[model samples]
Target: MSQAPASFSAVTPYRPSDAGRSLMVNDKHRQILDGLREISQESSSRGYHAKAVTSAVDGLRGCAFPVNSYLKDGNPNRRCIVYPDFEIEFEVGSYYGGPQTDVSIVDIRIFRSETKTNTRAALWNVTHTENESGSEWKRSRDPESQLKPTPKCSGTENDSIKIGINGFCKNIDHAISMLPSHITRGNETSLGKLKSSGYQLFYIPQSNSYFRAGWSFVRDLGRTSPSDLKSSQILASHMREAHENGLFIEWTSHRGGSKPLTQAMKLLAKQGVNVAGKQKVFLSDHTSSHFEADRARRAIGMNTTDSKWHNSTKGIAQLVGGQIFGGASLACSINELINHTKREELGGKIAVIGSTAIGGGIAINSTYEKIGKLIAEHGVSPALALSVLSVIGKTAIVGVAAASIPSLNENYHNGPQDPIKNLGNKIGKKLIPQG
Candidate 1:
């Protein structure tokens, strides 16, 4: 050892500055990184090109580049790292100077194949960043590119290939064949693998198709011991598949127990799954739900429809139809709320209370649900105003129930039908269009 130390040759140390601090890459980014490495190896100067990518990604750890620098009209929180060979796009909540930044890799792309300069930086379209309209290189404006388009979940063409199976898919191969061709190849493959395991494939009906709830399979934990092998396997498979496909998995339980859902999602995150935010997940129309409808009505001090009406076909039309009267009512009400809220004059002594719960709008009793919700949503300002009036002990706050209005209340109390029926018509005119 002493003799070797005496005659040691001077050589450059093989240590990368970001040896311990590397840019975090998601599943999609990881794939792109692997592909880029393969391409770099074929280049004339492999080491130089490969090292450039490493340096570019490592530099992103402490960079605070503007989102606009990548996506022209995207959220400011979205940012990207551009290198000669490729660009790595990511989203972070906020910017701070540190070795580690809270970020999620959204996409990674090499230069366009048609382009002459593979080792040059160039501007890219923000729309292309999401690959919403297909890959960044493809310029087709086909709406199918918009994968999760809600009302038009089947895309612009309503011609979705309907399938009916006589028997359950027994294996992963059968499940793949049964699935609609509309699903991406990667997803179909992963789903096949999942089904190939003991996991069952739950086919959703056409009505609930818009919800786009991914395969709802049950894992029987009763069969397993404390190890819970089956449950663990299913959860791991789903998390891996979802992350690989850049899908956001939102687990829910209708059984009044969130423990299973919470545990599964926690495990997914622990396994490095790209668990997307709630807002990113799309569900059925909010206005269609009675709870949402009631909330909206209370927010604007207007009873658009009764709870019964909100659950029927009338409620759905308000959200679906573009040229229908029900649709007009929703648009008008929302517009009114938006415009009114901007007004400086928010103080008023007159409060109109409406209730369809008792005798439509004819009952003497006010709808507490409506009033309570309104007060709660308006925040402290209204309560403070009422407090000031109470302190004065002179100003009167007139709370007039909608039923107290002579026009809506008089005959309604005597009539068997709801007073709110047919927009206060003596004869019940269809307030909602049947067609």
Candidate 2:
């Protein structure tokens, strides 16, 4: 392994975590989730993100400082519940077993695909670069190699720089079913493995899938229609099986205040998802001083209405062990503000929201949704699809992030539809590229 960076700074200033500090969670906004009980009574159907954020804020804040001194598992934060502001699901199998996985994503953008700009934005650049096998390439020459003339390194063979390739299809099952054939043909291999330690999946849709149900609908985004119960059994079964298999069943996501978001969260639950998280803000009543002061620190954080507040349902958090952390989901977008807290009162009470299956899709956008589902369903093309999905997710998110910047007016516009969008999507009625 390569040596760690020698001069890496391993310390953060002893600044307290506050409502304002949540801005650091992402490059976008600043916020604080004081309390959650209130929001639940207000909004009836925002979805998984709402509930997850509410619970996350309440739970995490409840445990953040109760134990000043750290020991081990005995302490509240014995485990650093590091919620990487983003995630993308990688398929493992069904409620049973398998080597390959289906691809999918859980995101807010899926529902927002109606607009032409959003649709264009959803379509992302997919690049298929060179892929190489691990066979050693020795420079040493015997009779054959030495006799041949050395190739000139004019320093320009774009083809030499390898990249990952993915094959997308309209029908998810169709795409997944084609994985083995591609593998057998010795096609699409990745050379640039992660150089850093630790494992992480890109939280993109099609890049994220499994299933969903109703109770989750109620628990996650707040609207529980009777129809959702249909898939509950299968979702629970899958979760239980995944738990038993010693794999991560990420039941949490960043979907929206819609029915689909709720459904997604429920499916993830049976998989032993760690916890849910969401956006939140400190709120106060017009009446009492103590009440106003205590508002942001109590169950008041649940009024997730505006973009500045935790806007999803509150029940999602109830599913996992409390893991609420602030989503910094706010209207306050300022770099300096993000780098530093907005007010001293911000830290008086830190809010932590639950996790979710929302942004996982939006970050990757709708174009890849079908691909994301394919992986989850079939667990096929795990490596190639994952690499491609991961890249597209990061790239698209980068595009979103670049736009979300305060300087850019915080509006996402991916531009006109073209080959750039839907990078891996085929033009004709072909599932995989034939050799």
Candidate 3:
């Protein structure tokens, strides 16, 4: 045995040639290598979902997704990410020779409809659609045609119908019955499964839906506290159902002051938050400092009623009635969202990217320094950039700031996470957008 060893022992997974080794090799490098391999192996395969997988992978070369691990609604040990759609594994390359490259991959998560799927076919299609929309990608080569054994989660590929439920459309029986006549073959689904069955799926409800019925009172220049109208019943109903169904509740509280975090942790702990906790829960909106409001306004965006274009009649009319405002001074559509997404990807800054504590945004890009400054001035994402959004905030609020001026976002994009270092203040006038 010691003579030459078995052939398998000599085989390394995959390695880059001498020229590919130059940088400090690490796990991230290995993962990128693995990802490359995964993509390469599938390069010549053409299935219903094959093209879709490749398309979704286009924008990833530069924007690598991270392996997100977090506590579920209650189970700390059980977790999953809401963004990644697939895991691309590979070994690292281009530095320190090929031997040091470890095996790794990028974990991707994709969420339900929105600010946001299933079997191999579903997953492939879901990712494919997403990739087609991104403007940051360059297309790859074509492939061969073949069928794959639908890979199962932990070795269970039942080829059953997978229904990804969005929000809490609880009337499962009705939803299935309502499917189009063409596909409803004697209760036969996407798969041959029958017996009127479907798995339940859920997402965190609109965080502040209950808080809005009496908005006339709560929206008093942000004077009202969340504790004023809450009940254990209401809170429990919203947060507990998903838990019962083994579904996770997305925490949607916006970060501002320290109080919000404290209350959120409590609520997440299965405890409820009332409306009057004032400093105990919701933080101040318009703070005493100018920077606080400035940053918040930047993150929270302009109120739907606020004018986006210049005050001039023509500009306001154009902006309000234009794509930015959804043709009516009040609405903004998915098309606008798609445009902004492209802008953000191109390294453009949004005047404001407003969100409630739990409201959604593109992604997390802030560091402790940017967080501290904003919090010291006015608190937000430094800790929690999520919150239960008010109806108006959810429907009408579009984050708008003074437009890209000398701010942390621009600073971070151009500099490093720890930018306060020797980078010096390259901050420019592009911080906030000015009308």
Candidate 4:
């Protein structure tokens, strides 16, 4: 254990009260401390002095405050507190097990402060800088070691061709010109021809695997505005179309819920649309003007009868214990977000989506009317092939469903031909980089 700073030694050591500990119910405070200790050790091995890591973790412990005061558990930055010289940030959640057994840890950042001449600086120096061997490590001055300055990409022609290393080009000619001659003018898919023809195609340095149905789509439905109302019309129409197409459509609304959106949905429902059976429309209560955070959450959507809303951050949580039909299996937690968003080089969301079998159905069914056109328009690649396969599998399910009628498979083709071969070639090119 390290000594507290002389100036702040009088400050009480931060420890959760019995009630606060009960909040986690399973001891998250210890978990956070353990995680920080492990991270500190790893950081030390990489170069940071162990003393600094210890001091930072200790300082973080000292900074802990009762979370009940804010009542904003959903806020990603809720646990974070910033001071004039330093900042401390962390994440809190128990996403897996019972919601009551969740945990909080300094997942974002711990104590990080600027060094200045003063008592604080002296305390920091004594606590963090000094090594057990009585030596100090200095930052390297080598230009190569330092981060390279971002290149300025200004002006039209140059910007169209090459902005920055991570920049994208709007001008199709410039985009194609940047690609290799073999790929650009080759007998690839429409996407490849587009490049050769000098059509606009934005450059994406990194590709995310969880393409659709990921965290990117999981947006917070906050207070509605004029734009939202207008968008609701579009949404209603889309929902109506999905209903006619016999696709399941479910939506949950918070922030007092939308009346106009509701009305639009009601109108569609009355017009022989199956609005409530397979899909559903979940609603929270109206947002109250005068109420505490917990009460507000209750007024909106949380069922206080369950006793879960009292401790829930901001009142919103997985509805009906994350039931597949009504409740979401995943909550709006950092861990859940990571599962949906995190992408690897070759696999990750891609593999997960492909493996699920649902993604394939979605891909094929989504483009049932325009599969060939899509392949022609977008260049065939490994990713596209996977998408096509997903579509095919989904189509097979639909075919099974429409087997009684048999007309459903009338326009559908037997198997993919040219596009599959083209995708293989593209994959080969990627596997064996052409120097």
Candidate 1 versus the native: TM-score? 0.20
Model 4 TM-score, 2 decimals: 0.17
Candidate 2 structure quality by residue, lDDT tens digits, 342-395: 332111111110011122222234424534344433323434334444443443
> What's the distance in Å from true for residue 139, model 2?
37
Q: How many backbone clashes does candidate 4 have?
A: 8
- The TM-score values for the models, in the order shown, are 0.20, 0.17, 0.20, 0.17
lDDT sort, best first: 1, 4, 3, 2
Where model 4 places Cα greater than 4 Å from the true spot, the runs are 1-9, 12-79, 82-86, 89-149, 153-435
TM-score head-to-head 3 vs 4, winner: 3
lDDT of 3 by residue, 324-386 (tens): 323221114222323434321211111112221112322233322332234322212322212
Q: Compute the lDDT for candidate 4.
A: 0.29
Q: By the TM-score metric, which is better: model 2 or model 4?
A: 2
Task: Give lDDT for model 3.
Answer: 0.24
lDDT of 4 by residue, 226-252 (tens): 433433333344444434444433233
Please list the residue runs of candidate 3 whose C-alpha ends up more than 4 Å from where it truly belongs after superposition: 1-48, 52-85, 89-103, 106-166, 171-435
